[model samples]
Target: MQRFRLADLAPAPWRNGGGVTREIARGALDGATDWDWRLSVARIAHDGPFSTFSGVDRVATLVDGAVRLESATQTQAWTTPGEAHGFAGETAFTARLDGGGARFFNVMVRRGRLVATVVAHRTSGVLAPAQDVQHGLLVLHGRFAVETPAGTERLEAEDGLLWAGARPALRATLDTPTGCLVEVRLSAPAQTDGAA
Candidate 1:
């Protein structure tokens, strides 16, 4: 298990070099967010044009402030941290801020290769049954404790924990009102022997 603090997150320019993103963790240590196995965390601060990523499945959640996102088919309004939006990273879209600016939490994986979900739970609750894939939890708000078969540890916003190999037992409880959670479940790759 690893812990990340938003206050400690480092921001960098987006892959497209348009805005900025905070890469929390990736691959083995976390999860890879590339053609093979892509997974990453980022935040957006400005409202401008939409950036496109090829062949990547992505989920973006509103952490702070309000953001309006538009796609070819429809437009989405993410007003609170609990609200999450899923899309094809390759799709064209733009982010329009309602005010000064907004902060977002994002996760991405290879398209068609894996499935992911983003959800917000109350201060005290347990995740429903999750099978077939690995689980990753990213705390979006407040300080909380994650109790798994391994043990219990405190997690602040931006902190993450991974339960891989097989489905593991887990639960979370927040100590504050600003608490939110983002859950990710990714499929494992099939093994194949080299050509004979």
Candidate 2:
């Protein structure tokens, strides 16, 4: 279990230079051109086309502001916060800001190696980890007290908790009236033996 504060991370310039992105976590950090999986938050400041990642699967959730995504065959309106929109990384898309700018959380995984899901949950109670899966909880709004075998942590907006490897028991209590939680679940890839 690890806790990450959003403010502590420095933003990196995006490949397209339309905005900046803050990488929260990645499967490999050895300066590789390709990684198995990655989680990040990006700030969209202007309307532009997204950078294409040929063989990656992407899931994006709106955290602040409003925007509409236009692809070749589809257009998606993201007005509600915490709602996730998924698309193929290879798809070319343009974004139009409803107001001015927007902040979004993104999860990308290499095709055929892993699968992922991002969902919003509004509740207060125990959140047990799923079997053979990685869990990442992003606090979108309000405050929370998360308890686990490691320890208890106080999380605020933009704060996240990552639990990988062995699934552990976790309990979360809302500190405010209502809060939004972005639950990220990643399926573990199958092990391959050097054969054939």
Candidate 3:
């Protein structure tokens, strides 16, 4: 098991010229591969247009202030905390700020082929052992500690964990505050741009 710190992550521009996204963790831990699923932690600093992804499934959850989301057909405003929505990656979407800019956590996975889920965990507990799916966890917005055969590592807001290849038993304890949980399930090998 490997742990990533939020403060250590560097924010970069979003792919395909969309808004900026801070890539916290990704499968294989390398920036080259076109991963089957990607876990990105980002802050929507402004309200404007968004980019379009043709073959991806996306999930967005608000972790901070109120914000509004608009697509080609509908416009919805998310004000409450932990409010999340999913959309097709091919569609064009834009974000409109309500009053002030808000922070949000986003997860994008390849549609039909790859599967992913995002959960905001606020209670104090431990995660049970499970197998069968490739998993990755990102600590967003709280202090959470994970224990494994390697050792104990504490994750603060914006930190992430990337796990691939095989399943290994792990345990976690939340003694600090609220945090977000993310896991990904992939079916095929990662696609490369040259092959496509």
Candidate 4:
């Protein structure tokens, strides 16, 4: 269990200079950039084509401001905070701000290798992750108390935790009336090759 402040992540300029991205966490078979799955936040600073990821699928959730994204086959406008959109990483879409600028939380999973789900949860009790499961929880609103093997700690909005292997019994409790969080749950799918 690792703690992070979303607003404090260091941003790296995009190769095309159209945006900046802050990687929250990633998992790779070889522990390198060739990620099996990745979680990140990106600032769409200008109008440019969304980069393509050959064997990946993506989910982008609007965090702040608004933007309109278009591709040859589809156009998506993110006008509301928390609105989420899913697409093939090879869609070749372009994005332009609908307002001032925009920020989004993104999840990308390598095709046929893993499965992922992103959802918003109004939390109040234990946020327990199975020992073999991977989870990312970003506090969208309110405060929380995270209990882990290390100790209990407090977290507020824009704070999060990325968790994976060698897990411990953990608990996360909402500190306010109602707290909302974006939950990214990743898991491996059962093999279908019939070689098991």
Candidate 5:
């Protein structure tokens, strides 16, 4: 398992003045440009439109301040911590900050190439073993413990663990009821994408 820290990630500024995106992990085929999926946390420093990703599908969770997300189909206001929302990456989406600024977690998957899911854990729990799957565990806020064959991992806010290839039999538990942990599970299509 590989651990990643938000503070340790390099900030990749957006071409426009929206904010910066710090990539946590990405799965590629042959090259970097051929990535089929990516997980990252982005800070919305200003209001702006999102870049279209053509064949990609994305899930966004509001992890910070207030913001409004508007798309051609619908508009949603995130006034507080809320559930994750999924949308077509090709859709023309725009964001408007409600107050100071906002930050969010994003999971993007190439349509037909891969399948991905996200679950927010608010209390202590055990995650049953999953076979032939890749997993990403992110502690959005609060103290948590991840138990695995490798050993127990202690994580704090913005800390994460990303693993590829073999799926581990593991369990995660929040230190308190006030904690939020996000789990992302990914699988490839039967057609394959060279390697995960």
Candidate 6:
């Protein structure tokens, strides 16, 4: 298990200059321009078109405030706190804030390389690990604590924990009844025999 402090993540401007994003983790295939998967949080301060990612799949959830997404076919889809929306990265869309601004947690995966699910709740219980896949939990609000075979760690707002390989059993307890959890699953690459 690995812990990532939210304070340690540096915010960077988006390529389209529409918002600021803080990347949590990223994986690539042979150092290619298109990454295999990426997890990040974006702070949208104004209305604008979302950057296109070609063949990537994206899931985004609002953590604070609210926003309305507009597309050609879909007129308007509103996302409030803890509400998640999934879409193809190639889809052209624009976001308009309901009020001041909004913060969103996003998970992006290359079309054929990975699949993911994100859930947010206000309760506490056992966090069963996913079989044959990577798992991660991010605290969006309040205080949360997790107990694992390795040890126990407390997570404050925005902190995250990532576990890879064999998933370990863990228990989660929430100090307050408000928080968000993100679950990500990576697809295993096909095995191949040694060949020229």
The model with the greatest TM-score is 5
Of candidates 6 and 3, the better by TM-score: 6
**Taking the tens digit of each residue's C-alpha lDDT, what string does model 3 give over 107-129?**
77766656665555565555555
Which scores higher on TM-score, 2 or 3?
Answer: 2
Pull out the clashing pairs in model 4.
none
Across 47-92, the per-residue lDDT of candidate 1 in tens digits comes to 6677777987888777778888887787988898768888888778
Local accuracy by lDDT, each model: 0.70, 0.84, 0.65, 0.80, 0.83, 0.78
Worst 10 residues of 4 by lDDT: 124-133
- Comparing 2 with 5 on lDDT, the higher-scoring candidate is 2
Prediction 2 global C-alpha lDDT: 0.84
Candidate 2 Cα misplacement greater than 4 A, ranges: 28-33, 189-196
Candidates, ranked, TM-score: 5, 2, 6, 4, 1, 3
Please identify which of the two predictions, 4 or 5, would achieve the higher TM-score against the true structure: 5
lDDT of 4 by residue, 38-157 (tens): 899999888887778998988898878899889878899887656788888888888978757788899999988777878776666665556445778787678878787788878898
CA error at residue 104 for candidate 6, angstroms? 1.0
Model 1 Cα shift for residue 90 (angstroms): 1.8
Q: How does candidate 5 fare on TM-score? A: 0.90
Displacement of residue 156 (Cα, Å) in model 6 is: 0.8
> Mind giving the per-residue lDDT tens digits that candidate 6 earns over 107-193?
888887777777775678876666745667788788888888878888888888877666766788888756665555565555668
Looking at model 2, residue 11 earns an lDDT score of 98
Off by over 4 Å in 1: 15-18, 28-37, 188-196
lDDT of 2 by residue, 104-131 (tens): 8999988877788787877777776676
For model 6, the local distance difference test gives 0.78
